[model samples]
Target: MQYRFDVQGMTCGHCERAVRQALVQVDPNAQVQIDRAQGRVDVTSDAPQDTLARAIAEEGYQVAAAA
Candidate 1:
């Protein structure tokens, strides 16, 4: 499955990396693409959207909503 979301509080490359790492921790094989300027993240994984969102939140980002 694939998931897309708009995230807030990502200001730089480090933030992008943090989000990607947080998602990967939930599903190591998942593909995560983040665009910090756009506050977007696209993830391909079997994990549910909520699970992924929680992971991102744990990393100190706010997931505004799924897109």
Candidate 2:
């Protein structure tokens, strides 16, 4: 499944990586894209969105509801 999140407080490469790492931790093969300018992250994974979102949150980033 593909999930899009409107993230808050993502400002740089590290922030993007943080979110990516989190998602990968859940679904190692998961694909992630971050739009720093728009404060959003897009993820595609077979795993559940809740699982993905929790991982992202555990990495210390805010994962907003999909817009």
Candidate 3:
């Protein structure tokens, strides 16, 4: 499934990598694309949305479902 989230607090490359790593840990095969300037993250994974959101949240970002 594909999920879109508004994730705040990503200011650099390291922040992007941390969010990607967090998502990958939840679903090893997950694909993550992030746009820090827009606070956006697009993910393609079989994992549930809530689980993915939690992973991002654990990485210290504020996560919300995107339209």
Candidate 4:
């Protein structure tokens, strides 16, 4: 499944990597794309939405479902 999230507090490459890593840890096969300027994250994975959101949150970012 594909999921979109509005994530805040990502201001650098490291922030992007952290979020990507967090998502990968939750689903190794997950694919993540982030746009820090827009505070958006697009992910393609079989993992549950809640699981993915929690992973991003654990990395110290605020995450919300994106319409």
Residue-wise C-alpha lDDT for candidate 2, range 1-67, written one tens digit per residue: 8899888878788888888888888999998888889987888899998888888788787886595
- Highest lDDT, which number? 3
**Each prediction's whole-model lDDT (CA):** 0.90, 0.85, 0.97, 0.96
Cand. 1 Cα-lDDT: 0.90
lDDT tens digits, residue span 24-49, model 3: 99999999999999999999999999
Q: In what order do the candidates fall by TM-score, top score first?
A: 3, 4, 1, 2
Q: Using Cα atoms with residue i matched to residue i, what is each candidate's TM-score against the true structure?
A: 0.93, 0.90, 0.97, 0.97
lDDT of 4 by residue, 1-67 (tens): 9999999999999999999999999999998999999999999999999999999999899999998
Compared with the true structure, model 3 gives a TM-score of 0.97
lDDT-wise, the better of 3 and 4 is 3
Clashing pairs in 3: none
lDDT of 4 at 63: 97
Question: Could you tally the backbone clashes for each prediction?
Answer: 0, 0, 0, 0
